[model samples]
Target chain A: DVKVTQSSRYLVKRTGEKVFLECVQDMDHENMFWYRQDPGLGLRLIYFSYDVKMKEKGDIPEGYSVSREKKERFSLILESASTNQTSMYLCASSSSGAGWGEQYFGPGTRLTVT
Target chain B: ELKVEQNPLFLSMQEGKNYTIYCNYSTTSDRLYWYRQDPGKSLESLFVLLSNGAVKQEGRLMASLDTKARLSTLHITAAVHDLSATYFCAGLMEYGNKLVFGAGTILRVKS
Candidate 1:
């Protein structure tokens, strides 16, 4: 079975603090994505990387950035955490070659900024 | 821009009852996906509808896609407590691998 692992399941940070959320997939998928889920807003994409050192901004990329240094690892960085940024973050990975376009998600990281 | 919308954002049903969740998309899409997410847990893939008039079923849940209408429906038959969760429908755009998701339908089933 494919597994997507997140560095933290729960995190609390102060306003103006820098935060990092890590995601690693064992499936060697070429595409990795970061999304923030909010009540009523649903899941909004923040950033995605198709390959190492390649990244693209998604629908809701403001206040967020991403890093993909290795094939199996992708990271989401919050330059400066704010109270409004508190939400559940999800990481997903998919292989383009599969042609299925189904994303396997990691257990989400619930972040609370105070 | 691609937009996905789901109707009946909140649903409460009794056991053995039937319900349906609707997903509508704004533009053309290469595929549609259905996912289930339990409270405070990760999403689990349910079905992938790749073409027009596609219908797939698992257990009591059936998903169908109509590309021309840019619509999809997930029908739940005989609801159960274990099936209570948030259901999300996502549309995969033609341009990239990005998926635009709809506001999920929160289903509460009482036995």
Candidate 2:
């Protein structure tokens, strides 16, 4: 079975603090993504990595960065935490095959910034 | 830019009823996906529609795609309390592996 695990299920941080959220997958997928889920905005992509050390910015990449140094690990970094950045973070992994394969998601991390 | 839209952002229904969630995309895409998410939980893969007229069913949920219309529908038959969750539909762009997702429909089923 494929499993994606997040570093923390809930987090709290103060403003101006630097925060890091980690994600690990056991499926050995080539594509990994980070998304933030808000009430009305739905799931907005923050960043994605297709290969180790290769990252791409998504629609809502501002104030967020990602690192993929290993195949099974992807990390999201918040340079400066703010109240507006408090949202549920999700990590997903998918295969890099020809067709559109389903993405497996982690349990998500709920971050609160004060 | 490709945009995905879903109708009826919130749905409330009683058990044993039937409902359909609609998802439309702004651009042409051959691959579509459906996902279900519980409150405070991550999303789970429900269906993947690859081509036009493609239909897949599992248990009480059925999903179909129409590439020409750029539309996909997730129809629920005999809904139950377990089916209460947020459903999202995403469109795979023609060029890249990025997926554009709709704003999800929140479903509530009452007994």
Among these predictions, the greatest lDDT belongs to 1
After superposing all C-alphas onto the true structure, candidate 1 shows an RMSD in angstroms of 1.0
TM-score of each: 0.97, 0.97
lDDT of every model, 2 decimals: 0.94, 0.93
Task: Single out the weakest 10-residue window by summed lDDT for candidate 2 chain A.
Answer: A95-104
What tens-digit string does per-residue lDDT give for candidate 1 at A85-105?
999999999888875478999
lDDT tens per residue, model 2, B46-94 = 9999889999999999999988888899999999999999999998777
Where does candidate 1 clash, by residue pair?
Answer: none
Provide the global lDDT of candidate 2 against the true structure.
Answer: 0.93
lDDT (10s digit) by residue, model 1, range B1-111: 888999889999999999999999999999999999999999999999999999999999999999999999999999999999999999987787888889999999999
Q: What DockQ does each listed candidate score?
A: 0.83, 0.75
- Model 2 agreement with the true structure over A4-111: per-residue lDDT tens digits: 999999999999999999999998899999999999999999999989999999999999999999999999999999999999999999888854456889999999
